[model samples]
Target: MPRVTIKEIARRAGVSKGAVSYALNGQPGVSDATRARVLKVAEELEWVPNRAARMLSAARSETFGLVLARTAKTLSEEPFYMGFIGGVESVLSTKGYALTIQVVPDLETEMAAYRKWSAERRVDAVIVVDLRVDDPRVPLLQKLELPALVVGDKSLAGGLTCVWTDSTTAMTEAVEHIAELGHQRIARVAGPPEHGHVWMRGQAFAAAADRLGLTGTVVHTDFSGDEGASVTRQLMTSGPDRPTAVIYDNDLMAVAGLGVIHELGLAVPDDVTIIAWDDSTLCRITHPTLSAMSHDVVEYGGRVAHHLFELLDGAEPAAHLNSTPKLQIRGSSGPPPA
Candidate 1:
C-alpha cells in the first residue's frame, strides 16, 4: 500500500496543493467549503499529514515555553509550582502542545535562554513568572514579538496579558485578622523582595499594620524551611516586644516557623499565632493545622494555558483573571493576652 500526501489530496479534491496545505494546517487561506471538501476526501483516503513537515512548511513551533528564573531543583521541590505547572500541562496536553521548560540560575541566564529559544523559533509562546515592578521582561518580550502571559502584577504595562492573584488584598486581610484577634506586634517571613508578588504582600502587611496602629516588621528569606526557622528565631529573640503573630510567604517556611516556636518553648496560637500564604496540604497536616489564604493553583494554571492558546489562535488575549484568595481559619489563630 502506498502512503498518501497533501499533493495527492489536492489532486483528488480538485484544489491547489497550497489550498490543501492551508486547510490541513488549519491556517486561514482556503474558504470553509473548500477546507471541508479537502478534509473529507483526505479522511476517506486515510491520508495523515506529516506534522513535522507541516510545522516546518508553515513555520509553527507548536510548543509553549516556560522559562523559570529559578533552579530545576527548586522548582521540583516547591509544591506551589508543582501543582501550578501540572495544571498548565493539563490544558496544553489536550491541545496537542508540549511544554518546553527551562530553569536558569538568574534573570540574566533566563533572559538569555528566552532569546536563544525565541531566535531559533523553538517555541510558539512563553509564560513569564516572577515579574517585578517595572519588569524588564515585559518590554523585552514585546520586542521579541513573543506572545506572553505574565503571572504576576496586573499593574504591569506594555501590552503583556496579566494573570495574577490578589496577594496584596490577602495580606492586608490576614494582618487585619491577626490584629483583630488582639495581636499587636506582627512579623512577616517573606520571599525575596524582588518577586513582585512577595513585594506586594509585604507592602500590604506593612500598610495594614500602619493603618491599624500596630508594629509590623518583616524578614525576607529564600522560601526555605531552614531559612524560615532561622528567621523566626531571629525575630523572636531580637526584640523587646516579641511579635504575637507571624505571616509566612510559603507553607514550607510556616512549617519551619512552627519548629522554631516549639524549640523556643512557645505554643502555637497561645504564644504566637501563625499564618501563611501559598496555602497547600502541608498546612493541614501540621501539629496545629495552619490558618492560611487559599487559592486554586491548579485552576489558575489551566486558565493561563487557556489564555496562551487564545493568543496562539491570533486573538488578543482576554482581560486578566485575578484569583481571589480566601482566609481559611484553622487551629493556628486565637485571641492574644487579655
Candidate 2:
C-alpha cells in the first residue's frame, strides 16, 4: 500500500493542503472543528508522519547509534555486548528514543557508518566502544562534528565525553590475588592488543607481576572460545614450564580454557587456576565456577548512555570513572599444587 499523503488527507477532508497541514501540526490558523475533522480524516486514512519530514521540522532524530567493528559470530557469542545493549535500552526506552546498531568487519567500515549516519542525520548521537591507541575514530568523529561518547579511558577518548572502568586497577588486583595465592608463574590470555583497554590492562599486568616478582607472560587472541582453548592447550603442553595461574580477558575464553584443562586431566586449583573478566553468568555455571573480575556491565552501559544524553543536553565533554571491577573469588582459583 502507498503512503497516505497530506494532500490526500486534505482532499478527503474537503480542505486546502495548507489547512490540513495547520490542523495536523496544531497551528493556530485552523479552527478546532476543522482540526478535528482533518485529524479524523487522517486517522481514517491511516496516515503517519514521514521520519525525514519530522526530522526536518524538529531537527531531532530521537535516536542513537552504535557500530561494532566485530564479526557477527563474535557479537552473537559475546555476553558483554548483550548486557551492555540491554543497559543502553533500559535508558533509551524511557526517553522515547531508539538505538540503531550495525556490525562491521573493520574500522574503515565502521567509519563509513559514522559518515553515513552524519550525512543522513540518522542518529542524535553515537556510542563508540573498543578504543585503540591513537584511535582514528576520535579525529573522524570530530571532523564530522557528530555528538559522541567514548566508552574508554580519558587518554583514549581524545577530549570526547567518556565513561570508563579502572581496568588497570582491576588487573593489578587480579595479579596480586594470584600472587598471594602462591602462584609465581602467571599468564594472561588477552584480547586483541590494539584495543585501548586491553593495552592498558596488559601494561598493568606486567607492572604488577614485576612488583610482586612473579614471572609473567601474555598471549593475545580474538577473545574467542576456540582461540582461548588453543592458547590454554599450548601453555599447558609447553614442556613442563606452564603458568600455574591464568587470567582471561573475557568469560567465554575462561570457560573454554577450563574445558581444555579438564581434558588434559588437570584438576582446578591443583594443576592450574583460572580467572575471567566481565563476570558474566557463564562464570557461575562452569564446573568449578571461575574466579572473575566482577563488575556490572549493564550499569556500565547505562552510564555511557546517560553521558551521551548529558552531552546532547549541551553539557561539557568530560570523563567519568564508573567503578573498578573487583575480584570475585570462586572454586577455580587457589594456591598452586604443593
Candidate 3:
C-alpha cells in the first residue's frame, strides 16, 4: 500500500492543494465546511500527517514564548510568576517542548518580541500575561495569526482563549471579611489601574465597602515593594482617619506594607489588618503571618500552559475559569481595635 499525500487528498476532495494544506495544518484559509469536507475525504483515504514533513511545512518551533514587561529582579522576587513558570515548565518539559522567556522593560518591547517571535517562528505559540484594559496585544496576536493563551479575563483578551482566576469574588470576600472585623476605614493597595484584574479588584473593593457601610479608599501602585511601602506610609500618617486595614494586590506589596506598618509603630491585626493576594511564601514568612487570598498559583500556571497546548491541538477559543481564591485568615487579620 502506498502512503497518502496531500495531493491525493486534494484531488479526491476536489479542492485545491492549497486548501487541503490549510485544512490539514489547521490554518485559517479554508472555511470550516470546506475543512470538514477535506478532513472527511482525507479520513476516507486513511491519511496520516507526516510529522517531520508537517513540522517543516507548518514551521513548528516546538517552543512557546512568554515575555514579561518587568526587570529580571522583579521576576525573581515575584512568587506567583515563579511558581507559574515552574508549573508551565513541568508540562512543557514533559511534552518535549521548550519555553523561551524574555524580560522586557515596556509594552513596546514586549510587542516587538511578539512580532519577532511570530515572524521568525521562534515559538509555535505564546502565553500572554498581565493583560491591560483594551489590551492591544490581543488584536496584534490575532493579526499575526499566532496561537495565544491569554491568562486573563475574556473581556480583557478580546476573543482570545482565557484561563482566568475570578479576582472580583476574591476582592469582595476580602472586603466583606474586613468589614465584619469592624474595620471602618479600609485602604486597598492595588496594582496599576490600567491592568484589568487590578481594576476589577478595585471595583469589587469599592462596591463591597459601599454596601458594608465602610470607608474605602483604593490606592493604585505599580506592584512594587517601594511603592507599596510608600503608599502604606502615606496612608498611615497622612491624617488621623488612617485606614485600619489594607488589602494588597500581590504578596510582595503586602509584605512591604507589613514592614511599613511596623515602622510607623503600628502592629499587624491589632492596629492595622493586612490581606495579601496569591498567598505566596512571603505571606507565610511575615511576622504575624499575612492573611491572604489563597490559590494554587503553580497549578494556575499549569492550567494556562495546558490550555495553550489545547489551542495548538485545535481547541476552540473560550473562557476557562480556574480555581477561585479563598480568604485564608491568619495572624495578620483579627477583630479591629476596640
How well is each residue in 1-338 modelled by candidate 3, as lDDT tens digits?
A: 36988888988889999999999889999999999999999899888887667666765788999999877877878888899999999889889999999999999999999999987778989999999999989999999998999998777889989999898899999999998898999999988899999988888888999999999988888888889999999999978788889899999999998998899888888989999999988888889999999999999988988888999999999999999999999999987777
Count of clashing pairs, candidate 3? 0
Candidate 3's C-alpha runs over 4 A off are 1-56
Model 1, 184-230: lDDT tens digits are 88899999998888988887888899999999888899877778999
lDDT of 2 by residue, 182-251 (tens): 9989999999999999999999999999999999999999988899999999999886678999999999
Global lDDT of model 2:
0.93
Once model 3 is optimally superposed onto the true structure by TM-score, how far is the C-alpha of residue 153 displaced, in angstroms?
A: 0.8
The C-alpha RMSD of each candidate to the native structure, in angstroms, is: 5.4, 1.1, 10.0
**Best-fitting candidate, measured by lDDT?**
2
Q: How accurate is candidate 1 locally (lDDT)?
A: 0.85
In model 3, what lDDT does residue 329 have?
Answer: 95
Please state the error at residue 50 of candidate 1 in Å.
6.7
Give each model's whole-structure lDDT. Answer: 0.85, 0.93, 0.90
TM, every model: 0.83, 0.98, 0.83
Residue pairs with backbone atoms closer than 3 Å in model 2 (clashes) = none
